[model samples]
Every structure is written in C-alpha cells, then in structure tokens.
Target: MANEYYEFFCPVKMVAGFKALEHIPFELSSHDASRPLIITDRGVRGVGLVDIVTKALEAADMQAIDIFDDVPPDSSMITVATIAALYREKECDSILAIGGGSVIDTAKGVNILVSEGGDDLRAYSGTGVVKSPLNPFFVIPTTAGTGSETTNVSVIKDDKTGAKVPFVSPFLLPDAAILDPRMTLSLPPKITAATGMDALTHAVESFTGLAKNPISDAYATAAMKKIVTHLPEVLKNPSDAAGRLQLAEASTMAGIAFSNSMVGMVHSLGHSVGAKCHVPHGLCMSILMPHVLEFNLSVSSENIGELLLHVAGSDVYASTPVAERPAKAIATIIALKEEMYALCELPRKLSETGSVKETDLEDIARMALDDGSMLLNPIDATFEQALSVLKKAF
Candidate 1:
C-alpha cells in the first residue's frame, strides 16, 4: 500500500432511506436545535416539500422560525447576505438546508455570517479560516449529487468579481445529513442523469487524482461500482425506491471521497464553465468528464486503470502493459459516458449543450487555471492543455 496515509473527516450523521425527512426533527434535537431556519430554493417551496418538512419539525416540537427560499441555481454572496439577515432577524439557532447544492451552500454561507456577524462572505475564503463552529446545521439533499451535504466546502459566487469562491472550513460541514429517497422522487429525469453523472465524476476524479489514498480509494471504488450499476436503473425508473436508495448512498460516498481528497481537471473546467458560461454545474461536469479523463490519462493511468477494474470488474491493466493502462482507462471512461448519455438521452458533447462556443475555449482555459480545484490535478496543466481538453469537449 506504499505507507498509505488517509484522513476520513465526514462529521455529518447521515440518515438515508425512504422516510428520511421524518427523522430530521429528532436529528435536530440531538444537536440541541430548538429553532431552525429552513433554507431552500423557491423551486423546492413550489413543490410543497417545504410544507411537509415544516410539519415534520412541528411534530417534533421544533420551531421553524424562518424559511428562506430565495436561493438561486448559482447562489451569490448577495443571496447569502440576505439569508444571513433573515437568520438574525428570526433569531434562529440552527439551519435546515433542504434542496440541492445551491441551497446547502447558501445555508453554509448564511451560517458564516449568522455565527460570526460578518457582512462580507469573502473574508472566510480559504480553507480552515473559520475558527469557531457555526450553528447546528443539518443538510437534507433533494438531489443525489454534489455531496454538499457531507462536504467541508461550500461554493458561492461573488457578484462583484464573477468568481466562484469555495468556503473551505471544518465548521462548514453539516452537522447532520438526511438522504431520503422520497426527496429525490420528484426530481426530473434530466436532473437525475446530470447529478448521477456528477457523482460518477467525483468518484472517478478522486480515485485518479494526485491525492488518492487507500481510504478514499476504497470509498471511491465502492461509489463507482454502485453508481455504474444503479444509475441506469434509477434513470429507467425514477420511483424505484431501491434504485434511488443505492444512488443516494453512492452519491454520499463519492462526496466523502472527493471532499477529503478533492477532484481534478473535470471540476476545474466545470466550475470555470459554470461560473462564466451559466451552464448548470452537473451538466458541465457531464459534458467535460470524458475529455478530462482522456487528458489526465497520460499521468493518472495506473490509478484510473485500477478504478476501471473496480467499477467494471475488468482487469484491463493485467491484459495490457502498464504503459497502455492509461489509454485503456480513458477509452473505458469515454465508453461509459457514451453509454450513460444513451441510457439517459443526454447530450454527449459541449456542442450538444448549445451553451458553449469554440471562441469561449480561451476564457474557459484561463478560468480553469485559476480554479482552486486545479491544484489537485495529477499533472500540471498548461493553458494549451486545458484548451485542447475544451476543444475535445466542444
């Protein structure tokens, strides 16, 4: 194992199943949260799940002091400040984030200000900057991707700079996470595919990146196997409770893996594209994953080959020389992405998305170079390399 050193740091008490939302009140009680601010987006509120959650809290004798449902897809610092003001006004002692990454990141951002009384969120930009723990925060992810519920990082955009800043702090990790399959039942098929692919991206990147460790590799391998087996089934039948549960578990495991070890070029490029071009985060991830894997194969082939064997139960490594493993792994990932796209009827290329342009390649490459996630890449990427990867996607 080459003296493998691993650090596992998921602090969230994850409760996942069919009726997971019904148990949140008890989880809140364990954290001594009497008054919680439920943070979600307007879309969630429109779906009426917010009312169901409110009733559950009421049943558990926990007061829902405020419900902030103003979060947008790519949440901004202004939105975080607005939610923080509301949190203070309501005198809420805890946060219940109940939606996708945007809602969870918004809750994490609001927690920073509500706990520390800061007007500017950019003050705590770097890792481990928060000295004190935030309020009792519980993350209930509505989607089966992003793993924001179990991560120590929260991504929020700064409107002034148009830069996506990640707030990395142990304090930002949710104290509890509820992963009910029912919460994901209402997700559209496109969302299911995108988020599932996002989870797959996390596992693949974590396993193949420079920071791979035995523990994270174990989690990533398990997540990859489960996702590869179950994602197609879940897409075929979204209401299949068993399939949904497996997908949710896979997403959680992938989140834990990537949060500790971090993701690579796919995320770097995805984050840049999402920030600049206004593409959905998961969609960008899905579009760029195959190309990024191909680009990373030269340096990351051995790790990727092992992961491929784990996911597909095929020892392409043993059949081929070590020199050929990377190319084989890259080809495997490309094939898997094509299969997923066919199964889910999703777009396979950046050109299929109709949002990106051949002209945007330079800007995307520059932004990706500046992305924090790029540091974890197995190989140092040149602007030309990034441009080539983007071109392949396009």
Candidate 2:
C-alpha cells in the first residue's frame, strides 16, 4: 500500500448515523430532484422499510413519484426498461433505491435508460461505456453488505442475451448514500452474520489483492477492524443501534476499498460457487475466504500478516510472532465463522450449504477461472489449482 501509483475515487455523499433517512428530502432538494421514483423489492417493502422511508419523506412534505417494489432477485434488463418507462410516465427527476444489491442495480439501470433515453442496456454494457452522468440517484441499503451503494458497477441480467451484463462506469455512482440503523435493524441473525462476513471479506480481499494502494488500504483496514469488533455485538443484540451503524460504516468503507482496489480469488471462487450452487453470495465468501487467503499466502504473506492487527485486536497481533501473524489472521477468520455458525447457523463448509454437491466442485473451479475477479488475484490461478481450492473448501 506504500509508494505505488494507483487511482481511487468515491464522490457519492455519505449521510450516516441516527435518523439518516430523515436527510433524504434535503439531499433530494440539494440535487434539485423532488420527483424521485423509489426503487425496491418485495423483501424490503415487506419488512416495512419502504414505509419507513416513505414516512420520512411525507414528514418533509415530499411525495415520491412512484414506488416500484417488484424488483426480482435476478433483476433483468426488461425490469430496468419497465422502471424507465414508469419514470418517464411519472416525470421522475431522480431515483431513490431502497434495498439490497439487486434493487440498487435495477435503479442504476433505470437511471441509465431514463436519463440517457435508451431502452437497451446492451448499448452500454461494458467498462467506461456510459459517457454522460446519470440522474440524481440515491441509495439506502437495507443490508450492510454488497456495498453497491458505493460502487460504480451495475449488473443487469440481459434476458435477451442470457448473460448477466456488467455496466461499469463512473456515471453509475449515486448522488448520495444514506445509512440509518433503522434500515438494518430488521435483519435476522443468519443474514446479519452472512452480510457481516461478506463485508469483512471485501476488506480483506481489497487489502491483499494486487491493486491495493495506500488510500484503499486505509479504508480496507478500518473496515476490517470495525467488522471484527462490531459484528458479534450486533449478532448478540440486534437492537444495538450503534453497532448496526458501525457495521453499515464498515460495509461502505469496504465497498469504497474494493471499488478502487478490486477483489481477488475469494470473490472469483465465491462468484462461481454462487452461480453454480445457488448458495448465498455472502455465505460463499464466508466459507471460501480463509481457504483463498491461505492459497494466496505464498505471495501475499506480508500484507496478509498485517491484516491480523485489524482482524484481531492490536494486543493479540502484538503478542503473535510477526512471522506467524498471517496464520493468526486466517485462524481469526475461522473463529469468527465458528462463532457465527453457533449463533446463527452460518455454514462453515460448502457441503453444509445444502445447495452444492461434490460433483459441482469441478464445474465451480472451471467457472472461476473465467471470472474477471481472478485477474486481480496475486496468484495466477489455473483450473487445477482452483479445483484444489474448491475441493478443500468442500
């Protein structure tokens, strides 16, 4: 992370703390965007999150342009188009995404179409493709994971092409990201455990990945320390508003880190495992994080060792031999997973996921070699090595 040439950028305004949702109306007014469409999914609306946001807006005497709450888990280009059409019909001037990854991504896709006047996302499906800025967009993530609120990437499944299309552009960044404890207080124990682990993985991968720089490392390490300290506290008492806020901050910090430094083999293998096995993405990261880190230890040992100071306390890091800190960090991750498994039944093995079978290992490894995230890994993984890692994880 020292003396390296790298790029980092995160322009989205962050509004976090108690009653952060109350600032949404002011943020909208700052962007001169009053008629904003609320994009969400059934899970968020069902949990009364949308109602909470809506009430906040109404308290400010602001009415939303519309509320689209049918966003599917695998949001498609067609969904983006429908939202764009509704945005036009309702004369929406902005977008407020209020859910997890899929909803935020759908909102980004809709902003692309409505702001740029296009029905097909294929026209802007690659890196740096969007030339113009999007509409006044904002996000309020219901879960403290994924960090889609801070990233400049959106993946919309193109049902026409049968591919999960990646729309990468700085223009995809939102005007603001609102974090309030109220948004995540409803998360179940298992979900909290999984998403917390996911954020921790993002920080670890960013700090240890090939593109790490001083700026990203700062965000990544801070994120790791916060997640390590606060995740269990939140799991023990879900009503802990302060802990919920800390977890949210960690997720956003990790998001900022990876958005600049990117991820590595863990995400590569995790993505493949998720695609092939239908395992939840966070659980895939949780199960595979330590294994992938151990594999990368051959080349990333020093950086991995430094992570011990964040994963465990500085006192533990100081007590451990420097030569053994990386191993200690890896052991700390395993212990965290064990605690989560006991607290919330978060699976510690691929087989325990109930979705992945032994036969799926080879296919998962093969798919992982093609994953873009693998390119950033310090180790240039091959099919056999990826398979070896998957088999070990299984």
Candidate 3:
C-alpha cells in the first residue's frame, strides 16, 4: 500500500536515560553555544538539581551567562518579558531550560523577545508568527509530564485578563531535549500521581480525539499502557528508578503523540479550569479525566475500548456486548481514577479541592470554547455541553 500523506515534525534531538545530564555539554558544544542562559523555577533550585546542571556545564567549560529561577507554577507573560530583557543584557546566545513545563515555557516565551525584539507578548499569540528561530535552546524536563521539552507550543498566562494564551510556532521547538529519570526521582507522591495522570490523559485524548492517525495511535496506545502499569508503582515508591524511567519514557512518548495529533475536551476544560482557579495543571487534568472520557466515549468507543484492553490487558470489547463497550471503557477509566486517588490521596471532585461554584461552570465552558484544543475533539462540544461535563466532573 502507498503511504498516506501526513505531517510529522519534531526537530529536537532527544537525549534520555539515567545520568542524561552528562550529555548536555556535548549537545551545547555541538551547537556552538558557550554562554548559555539557564531558566528554571526556585523549587527546582531548592532541590539542588539546578546546581547539579550548572556544575555539569561548568565542568564542560561552558559558562552560564545568567540563571533565571523565578518562574512560577503557571508562568505569566510579565515573567517572560523580564527574562527576555535579562537575556538581552547578558548577550546570551543560547538558553538551557531546566525544570518542568512552566520553566521551559517561560524560556520559550523569552526566546520570542530575545530573537524577535518584542516588548508585548500579546503581539505573538497565534501559530507560525515568528519569522526566525530563537536562541539555540535545550530543554531538560524534571517532570514526567507536560512534554514541553518536545513541543513547539508554549503556554503563558495573560495577567491582565487571566487568560492562558498559547504561542505556537515551529521555531518554538527546542534544539534538544534531555530527559533524565534522576531529575524526577525526588518528585513528591502528589506530583507523581498528577503528572502521570496528565500523561495518561494526553495518550487517551490523542488516541480518541479527531486527529487520530496511525502513527499517533501507536504512540498513544503504548504510552497509555506504560502509564497504567508504572504510575502506581512510582507513587507507592518515589525512588523506584525503573518505574520512574518507564514513566519518563511514557510521558515523552505521549507528549510526542499529543504534540502531533493534539488533545481534546479534557485539555480544553483542564486549561480553562486551571487558568481561572489557579489550580495545578495536572491536578485539573486528574480531576476532570474520568468525566471527559465518559463524555467522549459515545463517539470514540472503539478506540477507547482498544485503549482499555491495552491498559488492563483484557479484551473488554469481546467480553462486553458491542453496544456496551463504550460504557465499559468509561467504567475502566473511572476505576483507574479511583485507583489513582487511593494511591495519591488526591481529591476526586473539583469542589473537594476548593470553592468552585456552579456559577464558574459557564465561564469555564466559555473559556474552553476559545481554547485551540477544543477544535480537535472527536465530538464537537458546545458551551452548554462543556458546562455539563464540568458539572459532571464537579
């Protein structure tokens, strides 16, 4: 059979394994980047991971021109601008983003200004707007999820209106991504659970959403199975190096999958809820996953059933009637959610976490409708339908 036409683009050179930090200097040297700017969060600095990376760079005779460690959980545009100004002042030719999605994303945001000389972040919110590549940037992810290291998109929150905006450009993709399990070995149980579930959501959504293709399906299915098996073990023992390695690989695979095919309503709602409530991105994803799976099952039953078989190692479709397969998948997802809650002691409902009112539903739905991810859902959802999903999740 002739190959069908489809676009697959991931230019980042991925370096992964135990002690992956040792290779960062080689990667930077290959790119001719000597004076690099390191972007990370203070929490990561507190853990001493940042110091470890700096030591590695110094040992390789590479100088860190500046280190920006002030990136917050959900980074704002102001933060990006501040870092951009600093990068310009330092005359840094490259960026080293070390930490989770927020830090990497902030680096990407700052890259826009350092490369393009923009003072206003609002000016570069859409896709393919950047004409030139930013600094030769390397991404080192400390979390098992987000996949920001491999993606061409960077999400930043607008402080003025409290909206999370995405900066999409092929140029935003990192020059390299270094995934070391050691970086995530110290992740707290709550973060382990939440981020693992976030990766699972990405896999499931990419497999079942409107953009499903053979390549993405392969990646997503493998990621989902790895996540289901390894997530529990990692939560039970945070220092389980093998389990953490599997999860790191799975999360990277899922990121590649979703970055190519994109996610669905789960992400749409997750983004909206996180932006409005200041909830952790993974926590919102964890709380809303089951309901979103149920909502999409009607249209994506076969694929969802296949995913269930892969995750549970059981052919749910053959055991259940054809008409009941969708329900079986939904039930399986809910069961997994319960398992996650038990493992991590995470809250099941939104209200359990905080004071989210019914009034918030309408706004969340409206915000979701504006999200670019919603356009790729298997079943097109209206604002009212999104509200219903939020209510069910609540």
Q: What C-alpha lDDT do the candidate models reach, one value each?
A: 0.84, 0.93, 0.85
TM-score list, all predictions: 0.92, 0.98, 0.92
Give per-residue CA lDDT, model 1, range 160-224, as digits (tens).
99978888888898888888777787888888888988998999899888788878888899998
Sort all candidates by TM-score, best to worst: 2, 1, 3
Residue lDDT tens for model 2, 1-394: 6666899999989999999999999999999989989999988999899999989999999988799999999989999999999999999999999999999999999999998887887898899989988889999999998999999999989997789999999999999999999999999989998999999999999999989999999999999999989999999999999999999999999999999999999999999999988899999999999999999999999999999999998899999999999999999999999999988889999999999999999999999999999999999998999999998998
Alpha-carbon runs more than 4 Å astray in model 3: 1-5, 118-123, 158-163, 314-324
Candidate 3 per-residue C-alpha lDDT over 1-394 given as tens digits, one digit per residue, 9 for 90 to 100: 7554556677778798878898988898888878889999999989998888988888888778988999998889999999988988889988999899889888999888888887898899988888687778998888998877778898899999997888999999898888888889999988888898899888988888877788878888899889988998888888898899899889988998999889998999998998778778888888898788788777777877676576776655467776776677667767777887898777778887685677788899999998878898888888889999999888
Candidate number with the higher lDDT (1 or 2)? 2
Clash pairs for candidate 3: none
Best candidate, lDDT-wise?
Answer: 2
Superposing all C-alpha atoms, what RMSD in Å does each candidate have to the true structure? 2.4, 1.2, 2.5
